[model samples]
Target: MSIMTQLEFELEFSQSEKQIAKYILNHGEEVLSMSVKELAKETYTSPATIVRLCKKIGLEGYNDFKIKYSAELQYDLHHTDRIDVNFPFSKDDSYPMICHKLSSLYQEVIADTIKLIDFTELNKIVDLLYPHQHIDIYGSGNSLLAAMSFQHKMMRISRDVNLRILHGEQVFMSYNSNSSRIAMIISYSGETNENIQIAQTLKENNTPIIVLTSVGDNRLSHYADYILNIGSREKIFTKIAPFASQISIEYLFNVIFSCIFQKDYEQNIQNKISYDKKNDFRHPLSSPVSDEIK
Candidate 1:
């Protein structure tokens, strides 16, 4: 089922069934090949309950339901490992199948990116970040690691202005707004309601908002004055968007950084020198530097 269709039906599942539904929805990678008993244990429901839930969701049996849902989620994750490595009985024709589909996916990514990007809107966004005293990035889960990687890159090239806010206090620290100027919220789905609220609150407080999100039509995207789109199909996960979107977001961020550096050729060199010097903290490892200096 498509993500929207699954969400629609899942919303109707009874309280007990909802747990099973939510587990499969959120943990698609783990659930894709799980046995009925395994799924039941993971969902904290009995095998009988898993069967009942599958029937209610309009599947013939547990295997039938699992197969359909598994295929959909696997397609969303861009994982063809199992299919490519089929059993001895299976034919080798799948090599061509895999090649054709993955190549198509790549072209789709390029086309979708081009269609979604608005140059005028993007230029407006650059203007906002261009003048910021500092740029604070907010993300959690798998995204937090990506945010930190981006922060490391910017800090290395642009000195102290980039922050990767992982813990509690540092995230809310921007509210003071005494030094830092802008905030970028990185979430594959704009539906990360907490991240959305952060952007909303920042807007309320007069801090500009820049969003990196996969869903172009989401509620949070509507509020965002500047958006960098990550065009991954959000089918494998429910509590958040798909992980494949990371490729797109990282690609966009690198572009933004390159643009900034390109525009300020001389300052890019100066900033690099300053940031390098700032990061080079010295301590005596083998000798007393004070005595040597004297």
Candidate 2:
């Protein structure tokens, strides 16, 4: 997990630990150069307390924590061009600057997502997405939009997929879906009650479920047959758009779709070819004489 992820998962942290976390989150790059004693002094806590905080978050010690933070910080500094998710662009920014920031934001979101992906689990989900299996995807709002995108991709390759954007539709789909069917839920918060209800219904029906959510366990993760996490560092104020989380989810979904696409690449190509030929009549071509008259 990234240091930022650890900080976000601090629901059980002590007051001193939270204080240290807040400082480190604000000045992660600066933390890289500070010693344990320095951090303890700055956070107004003991050195032992700092080390304990590091261990609580899965780091070995303060030094180990610093190393991880420094490495991630360096990667972000070098690769992302410093696009702040909280303040991606300003009104006064020029077109070129906006372009640069947006581009960098996309790259950073995808990069962070890639770091969190578990290839083994991803392959398992891909295997389940074979042409024979029916996939029912459920989500709300923007997550539903992402599900529609995946549904479109699956359609192009002739895979069976149902996208349920409404709560009633999702429940109905889950109720009718058989054990052979698979369910994929896309929710960054993973706390959507309706989505969770759909997942539960599917589970009761013996349907396998794969969840794409932000890092850290949540109520939804408990029932998933397979869980996939995405990078999310956007703040509450930045809720103007769930940009980072949505991009992360879409990026991971693309990876899974590509894996499934490759599994039947030759067959899929042939199917496309046949489909195009069969649909050719639907797109009528005008004759040269008709064009000349026009």
Candidate 3:
């Protein structure tokens, strides 16, 4: 997986780390020269985190990365990218910056996520999953979290949703799957060795395979009966987190479920109402429904 993909996997990183990342993206050359101690003082993060950040930026260590970056700045100098003035350099101290950063990311994801949102492909995936007795989800490396999250949602509606997060055991368990089941593999790169292998294994066994990946044209998709492509993200050099990417995928699942649920909306509502009546799951609102016409 790419370094950016790994960035996406760090779903639980602190706001401070995000702030550090934002600062670095805005000023990479300056920070690249700074020692871990100095960078921590500037970013208000610990030296330990600075080392982690170095790794996050696809570097071996601070010294090695700084040397290369310093050389590049001196050697193959390129034209500067126009910094978006809207992102005011001094507007945020810390927490507000996180919100602004997230807001910007959300907007970008919405824009790129729409460019190739093929309803046809999405509907095809829905079809593949709709009537299946069991649905198996597979994702390795960074995307394993996404795979597990999807399985959680689907399992609410599906009694048999197989989520294979453990790579070795997943491969072992996949072969034992009944012929009636459908498998969906999640990979942002669409090139994860484990994901590709799982897709291949499923394809060879005649199990229907659905692939959810960023790039539509990949080896895994070649074997899939359905391809639901998410956001088309350009590579970011600083570090890329899949916050927006995962959001898009989760949105896709929600849309799919909404469509499926709409098929029998009336009955579904009735069932809910009946269940609430029996279980007292319904909450009484401050403004209650009236029996008589207003």
The most accurate candidate by TM-score is: 2
In model 2, the runs with Cα more than 4 Å from the true position are 1-81, 277-294
Error of 1 at 116 (Å): 1.9
TM-score of every candidate? 0.56, 0.69, 0.60
What are the per-residue Cα lDDT tens digits for candidate 1 across 1-294?
234334434534677778887787567667767888898888788888878876665577788876777766666467543222112113454877757655555555555566667788778877766666488777667666666666676665543455544466444754654324777777765566577667666777777778887642555676676887876453434322333455456667766776666678787887776654556557454556522322
- Any idea what lDDT model 2 has? 0.78
lDDT of 3 by residue, 52-81 (tens): 765655578778657755754553254133
Q: Which 10-residue span in candidate 3 carries the lowest summed lDDT? A: 79-88
- Give the alpha carbon lDDT tens digit for every residue of 158-184 in model 2: 777888654488889988977888888
Better of 1 and 3 by TM-score: 3
Q: Each candidate's root-mean-square deviation in Å?
A: 11.2, 5.6, 11.1
Compared with the true structure, the alpha-carbon lDDT of candidate 3 equals: 0.63
